[model samples]
Target: MGDLAFEPPRGGPTLWEIGIPDRSAAEFYIPDPDPNYINKLYVNHPDRFRQYGLWARYTDLYPDGDLVYTVGVSDYKTDWFFAQVTRKKDDDKYEGTTWQIKFNLETVNQTGTYKLRIALATAYVAELQVRVNNQNSNPPLFTTGLIGHDNTITRHGIHGIYRLYSIDVNGALLMEGENTIFLTQPMSSSALQGLMYDYIRLEAPPPNNSTKKI
Candidate 1:
């Protein structure tokens, strides 16, 4: 063996990435603990997410509507809430929520399949449905049906079990200019049923010459 070399398989080129893939949502916005439910150990601490009742803040932050995030203009640290949870209703019931992410593309690949990579920091009896462009798509683009039991939200923890999903997006569903991706968590029996996203990314279709050995 004069020389030995190995090259890993290449997936595709990343078009855009949101949040860091560190198996935790710590990088995202972590609001201060409510004054009524403060944990002194976490006050003004980096692990502010560990404080109790952080999940309830979602309703307080956006009382009238759900989250609408614009890629270029919004700042993840301040705009992206750490978790996607249900909203409390005046009837003393909880309801599901849908968050939107809007982005723009100068061009699109008409004949190739794009990949949407989503990493979950934690989940608790939740179903995540993803829809591209068409918010009312009956079947949706992808769905994680009834996943996870890691009650990280109520336990005052930042993360628990980690999961990653790669969804194939048909090129035809994308547009040349403005596009929107909707993330819906449809399990609302309890406030604890939710998901914390670790990271999310979209990849352009691989080129014909994607594989190479060097």
Candidate 2:
């Protein structure tokens, strides 16, 4: 429900609580990510087109979205990550997809609610995975449906943005030590021209349920 981006440094401790927030204008429904729950979301069409930064679509090949970057993700010519949509029509229910990330830690003590933060930033489109130790925390993952998709982009598409829904663990890492985190993002299906990436970070809970206000 909050934004914790551009903090001190990377691989360091995370924000105490109030995990990352969704930069998109669309409404999100995540019970909040943790080491346990494998959440799945359905991003309805016309709506994906109706709300958020994806406010409009282009007339490239299909009725898809576009990456905001001047260079394409596969262009290898620039540093920007472009995330477009592959769907042709606007009524498709969209399809299901998954991105795998790996994280490794020195002590495996980096325990907390890990989230797969998905923003529309096209620059972060590479296969980014963090591994703690050597285990692939949880699978099944999350995605937006592609029922009405046209699958004509032939390039990466943006279905929805995900974030690290870090749920608080009562200092669980103290029980272990070091850890790693993984992040993997495929191309989007729509043909729109834009990329989005909000900040992805971990969180800790506030004490006694005080100092909190939505």
- Residue-level lDDT of model 1, residues 121-199, one tens digit each, is 9999999999999999999889989998888998878788998898998777888889999999999999888999998
* Clash list (residue pairs), candidate 1: none
Separately for all candidates shown, the number of backbone clashes (residues 3 or more apart, or on different chains) is: 0, 90
RMSD to native for every prediction? 4.8, 15.6
lDDT (Cα, tens digit) per residue for candidate 2, span 135-214: 34444133332222222122223334343332233234322322323333334443332233434444333232222211
**lDDT of candidates 1 onward, in order:** 0.87, 0.30
Model 1 residue 184 distance off true place after TM-score fit, in angstroms: 0.2
Off by over 4 Å in 2: 1-178, 186-196, 208-214
TM-score of each: 0.91, 0.28
- At residue 193, candidate 1 shows an lDDT of 89
